[model samples]
Target: MSALVIQTMQPDFVESFHQALDAVARERRYLSMLEAPPLERLRDFVADLKHGNNPQFVAFDGARVVGWCDIRRHDREIHAHRGVLGMGIIDGYRGAGLGKRLIETTLAASWEIGLHRVELDAHADNTRAIRLYESVGFLREGVARDAVRIDGRFVDVIHMAILRG
Candidate 1:
């Protein structure tokens, strides 16, 4: 495995990013709550990469993009010190520590931007993700009951948060 290079997302990488996301979405059933957005919507999504103090990062193996993570600031004033995170890695790249690196990089960037806490939600059934979050000091704050419907069944989501000192 080549060294994973973490960098800010660029416009030219949108298509590759979308392809990687689609592959992961189809395989892991981790993000089953949402459908893959259209290319145009992805363009808009990428356009908001740095909106309102939000930052997005992409991981690459040589010239191929393997994963991405985004940290978006919370909207309310009371929660202004915190942010929400979303992440995904392509199918073939899982279990290679790339996800951890992606998350660590994102958290480091978030802390640098003055965010004191980062929160994320993962499906309760996603034990791999849960363990990874726990390994990085994210604690289970609560459970959102039936928060998402996947494959005609309601699935609970585990809400987790990591605070930076």
Candidate 2:
């Protein structure tokens, strides 16, 4: 219950960050990963993210990463004005208002990086996450039926986006 600090991800923190992500992924709740990518591959990926224009933020409790969020911009010129968002928080930190901070920080960073449209998809069953996104101005655009398979069953995915005014 110490102060939580939010900052841009750095190369040196990739391993711990990956471990944190894997822990959340294994919970079988939000994300669909059974295990995260190997350390070497994830290290390179994080390095690449550092070089890209996309903005990523990590919330830390001292040295441990409790949450992470990022906006990955489309590469093509026609789609470059938009970005896709992804985020996850460790199990113990779910309802403490950390998720809101992460999303808000990412949205602000998205605008700062010149992105006008930001989109995200959440499992339709994930009401808490969908509510969080909506509270921050994201609107449901459509639903991709059976878009995710979790624990052997399909789940609808809700596509949501927020356009800069």
Q: Which structure among the candidates has the greatest TM-score?
A: 2
- Give every collision pair in model 2: none
**Which window of ten consecutive residues has the lowest lDDT sum in model 2?**
27-36
Instruction: Let me know the TM-score candidate 1 reaches against the reference structure.
Output: 0.91
Candidate 2 Cα outliers beyond 4 Å, as residue runs: none
Q: Each model's C-alpha lDDT?
A: 0.86, 0.89
lDDT string for model 2 (1-165, tens) is: 689999999987787789888998887767756678898998887776668768888999989988999999888999999999989988888888999999999899899989999999998999999999999999999999988887788989899999987
Judged by lDDT, which candidate is best? 2
lDDT of 1 by residue, 25-110 (tens): 77647885355688889888888756676778899888788999999888799988999999998777889898898899889989
After best superposition, candidate 1 residue 154: deviation in angstroms? 2.6
Please give the lDDT score at residue 8 for candidate 2.
91
User: Which runs in model 1 stand beyond 4 Å of their true positions?
Assistant: 32-34
